[model samples]
Target chain A: MKTETTIQGLTASLASARSSKKMIGFVPTMGNLHEGHLTLVRAAKKICDVVVVSIFVNPIQFGVGEDFDSYPRTLEQDSRLLAEVGCDIIFAPSVEQMYGTQPRLTNISVGQITDDLCGKSRPGHFDGVAVVVTKLFNIVQPDYAFFGQKDYQQLAVIRQLVQDLNIPLEVIGVPIVRAEDGLALSSRNGYLTPEQRAIAPKIYQLLKQAEQQLRQGEMLEQVLANISTELTQAGFVVDYVEARQTNLQPIAQFDQDLVLFVAAKLGSTRLIDNLQINFKT
Target chain B: MKTETTIQGLTASLASARSSKKMIGFVPTMGNLHEGHLTLVRAAKKICDVVVVSIFVNPIQFGVGEDFDSYPRTLEQDSRLLAEVGCDIIFAPSVEQMYGTQPRLTNISVGQITDDLCGKSRPGHFDGVAVVVTKLFNIVQPDYAFFGQKDYQQLAVIRQLVQDLNIPLEVIGVPIVRAEDGLALSSRNGYLTPEQRAIAPKIYQLLKQAEQQLRQGEMLEQVLANISTELTQAGFVVDYVEARQTNLQPIAQFDQDLVLFVAAKLGSTRLIDNLQINFKT
Candidate 1:
């Protein structure tokens, strides 16, 4: 697989690929790869002639006091995994390469959608995500971009951005790839201690349980409160446990497609996960 | 010339154009075509195989009291002029067609540069411009986009947006097309009474005179004050008369590329003009 570290180099490569009428698929990630990321790459490879994966741990997306410095950087292993998964191009740019020496003056902000969920916990985080993703989208100009549903709010934000900006690309959100115990795989999973790792799956478990309860005609608010209580009892500092429509709009009554989202801190590491509940199904 | 009022029609047309490897040059305007807008079209025609012009009098760019509803849109005349100028496509989408039924949630904002000049008078104007231009840029995917330097701050804003967003297009700023009497051509110039038309040229004249005074070692603040006073005395409500770097950076001392900008109200119709000064030569 070809690896490009500069925007110019990637553009030149993509220009050649485009001229030959290749359908490019892009999967943007922060370097430390897992099954989840590989799944996105695999999905891209299935439908596209060229699958491009970008591994730049976007500094702007991490909030103050977040694990920006300690975020894992296993590039050698990551590239090997990407190659194994048949990713055609790997764009692994340095922070300085992704963002130049000068400060950037342009920002893309998606309102309403970014005011809740992960956005509530991390201020300016989605704005940072919006800008960087926009930059990458413009750089790659991919035909299709793959994103894992593990970051559900981010997926929604990206969808909103593409629609509002009229960016010409399809965004496909792949289902969350999880550990055998139902722990949603995340780069931050690497930060969890062995004991915390054992407990991490409980978050997903409770989310599933909440979905079941809602399906079985339990009250939404009561089920959410019980899950929050259950997480708090299990030593996790729960941020929020709420049910909303697939569009992230608050649901007064569960009559449509709904997703239950969770964010909590087990220790220094914060984790987030969600589950889509389709009533029609 | 072919006219597309729907995004799908334009995208499909552009897609076919792209398959043929035609270079697209785009000129986005508020219609009511004048010599200034036509000059941008002429510039686009010289370098590109396809010249596409979009006439959108974006409501988002106008403030509460601004002339959004009253904005002149001469589609029939505009298309005739575009055809005369050999424009390949005219994209004059309806407001609903461009924005859809829902409210726009995404905003593109350029900082620092947008906080001054016209931005000071028309709040959120550049943000509106940035979003619409970004939408148009993505829609057309033009190889080159043209803008007139008459709206100096806007040219700077567009350049910033392209750079910051990493949009793949060259933004070529054409010099302001002027009337024989030296008044900068503007669609808003249509609002001027015949008497006001005679007085409008003075705004451009004063900018040229200010450029000369600065080149002759006049104090920057004093020169600005003189221009403001002169305009005010000539039955105009002077908005601002200032000299700054060509990039709109405040110049404490005139040692670099400078531009003198003026915005004034002549009996309810506002006029703006600028003149670039080269000191290095």
Candidate 2:
């Protein structure tokens, strides 16, 4: 895949691609690729004439004492994976490249949507995500941008951003890619100990079991309780396993459009997962 | 001009125009086209195959009592001028069309740049400007966007915005277009009473004198005092007239890259004007 480290070069490439009426599908990431990222790439490849994958561990997105320093930088392996997956361009830019000379302090604020769940655990995390995504969106200028549903709230927030700020591109969300035993795939999963890895799938197992129970008319609260019990039993510190409306509002009713979002810790790795349940009432 | 009142139609027309490598020069205005606007259109026509002018009197930018309701809007005259200037497209979307269903509350903060000048007088004015410009930038997705330098701080703010947000469009700041009497042309110039209109030329007259004095190695304090004296003598209320670095930083040096920004009140109407001054030691 052709690579560019400069904004001018990328714009030139995009201009040519745009001239040809080529639909560009962009997948922007922080560059510690796993199955989830590949799934997004594959989805982008299916729809767009050109696929661009940008790998920049944006320093602006990480708060103090956060993973900015050690968020994993496996660009070589990531490039190989993108090549294998048939990406047309890998825009692996350095910090300076993404943020040009005298890059002014810029950020995007996600309001109440960021006040709970992972946001409560990590202040300024959503803002960081919003800021970086906005930067990436401009740099790529894709016709359609792909993101994973694993970041469900992020997907919602981005959708809001596009609508609110009038961002031009379509944000296409790909389904989460999980392991065979139901563990959600994440680069951070690599940081887990062997014993932690062994028990990681239990989070998904609990979510699936809760999904089954809700299908049998179990109360939303009870299902959450069951999932919480399973995660605790599996030695995981549960963050939240709330059932919410598809729009991220916590709800009492487990309607057809309910989304079960979960975030928990197994060792130092913070893993998040979600399932959209569309069962008939 | 192919006029579109909906976002989708505008996008379709714009996309078609751009896909063929047509150089699109965009002029985003709040309607009520004056001589200043016509000058920008003329410039756009010279450089682009497609000239799309958007008339959005953005409500977001108008704080309470900020002339949003009284903002001059002459669509028929504006349309006539645009057609005369050979504009390819006119996107004059309605408020409902511009703001979709359930618009999210997202504020595009304008940071330190907004804290001085008009921003100080009108709190959140730059934020509104930032949000609306972002929206227009997304909708037009132009190769180049044009702005008149009469709004000196605005040009600087937009330049910084494109840099900070990494917006993928060339921001072209056109020189301030003015009336025959040296009054910088503005739609709001229409709001001035016949007497207010006659004396409105004082803003430009003061800046020109200040520019001449600065070029002759006059101290900045004396120059500002001269400007303030001349403006107050001309039956205009002086808001501020100060020299600053092109980026809006307060400068003590006359021999530097500088801008002389002036804001004044003619009767009850407010007017602003600016000029670039390169100082040599």
Candidate 3:
């Protein structure tokens, strides 16, 4: 396994790999690797000839009061985990390396989909995700770029971004890694206190209720209302509980590709989770 | 010369051409190929082994009220001219072929430079240009993409966009093709009446004067004031006459790499022109 800190080195390495006919699979993540990140690495190893993982916490995605300053950085542990997972190369570019200078006030915005769930609560969050993803894409130039379904809407936005921008890469979505108790895995889960951790699973439990309602042939409006009430009663501030069609258009009638999404605040930190409720067998 | 209407045909053709390890130079033009466009082809032919010219009047770059419907499109004449200029392949795609059904709304925007100048006058003009150029970049994936410096700010924006997005192509700005009397060659010149064509050189002349003033240690304010008076006296509606940094930043002093830009309404049509003036030169 090789590690490169400079953009030029990683880019040359990737280009060299390509000329030699090695398929590259990439997992771009902010540092502090957990079991969830390792799952992505292991998946990349299984398919691609060369598995490249990039660990850089993107600061542009964070708005004024967000956790950019306090976001965890565990590069040593993260590097150790990648080495264990048979990773081919790791690109760890510093802030200066990622952005030569502050990118002059530009943004990449997807329409109502970004405006609906995570976008509404975080404000400029998806745009930040977009610009950073574009930067990483330029750096990694991976054949198959992987994103865990954990950040489900982010995955959706990225899919649209690649498609809209005509980016020549396959956007592969890995299923959400979950705890035994069904809580979705996220790096931000570190911010939760022990007591808050206990209640975190309840948010997923409420989402499951919304999923169950859809399974039982309940209408989207009733399912959304039921989930909203459930989250409110659990002492979680429900930002929005929406059941929409696969393209994220509001459900006038249920389609087999409907997705139920939730975003709420636990203590001072906000977390989001989503499930595709109506998958056909 | 081979003419391809689809991306697959062009790619196959270009790839086969590339098997010989030849350097490809591409010129992207909205067809209605005049002597000006042929000049770019001649330049491309002089240096490159493969010269690919794209002829498609991009619809997205024009505003709703703008002259997309009225824009002159001369495909037949363009093909003959390209052939005469020793062009290798002509890649022309329909809007549907270039943009897929589920067009991704994620677009590339280059910042403040677009915000002022032409961007302010024609709303979403650069957004359209950025999006269409991005589509062309993806479709053609040219080794070298060429643009004329007649659209001066556009050259700067494309340079920034390609760099910012990490697009793998070289953006080459060819010097503007000028008429015998020094009017910048443009497709929009078709809109000019006979009398209108006679005085079109005034726009270029005013910009040159501003450049001379800045070179001789004059303030931008006084230079702009004179240009505005000149245009108004000539019966053109002066839209904006401002002196800005070469990067399109507003200037507080008469120093540094400077550009004097002007846009005005001549009858119902809008024309923009600029002069690159380096004060310290």
Backbone clash numbers for all candidates listed: 0, 0, 0
DockQ of 2: 0.57
lDDT of 2 by residue, B78-183 (tens): 9999999898899999888877778565667767877888988888888878878888888888878899999878888888888888887889888888888998
Lowest summed lDDT window (length 10), candidate 3 chain A: A102-111
Q: What's the C-alpha lDDT at position B230 in model 2? A: 84
TM-score of 2: 0.93
Scoring each candidate complex against the real one, what DockQ results?
0.89, 0.57, 0.57
Interface DockQ of candidate 1: 0.89
In model 3, which regions exceed 4 Å deviation?
A: B16-22, B42-49, B209-220
Please write out the lDDT profile of model 3 over residues A1-281, one tens digit for every residue: 88999988997878767766678899999978888889988888888999989999888889889899999999899989999989999999998887777565456777767886878878888888898897788667787888888788888899998888777689988888878777788888899888778888887887787777678787778878888887777777888887777777776665567777888878877877888765676
lDDT string, candidate 2, A22-120, tens digits: 999999888899989998999998999999999888886667776778899998899999999999898888888777677465557878777787788
- Give the Cα error of residue B198 in candidate 3, in Å: 1.6
Q: Deviation in angstroms for B256 in model 3?
A: 3.7
| i-RMS, each model, one decimal | 0.6, 1.5, 2.1
What's the candidate order when arranged by decreasing TM-score? 1, 2, 3
lDDT tens digits by residue: candidate 1, B65-110: 8999998878999989999999999999998988889878999899
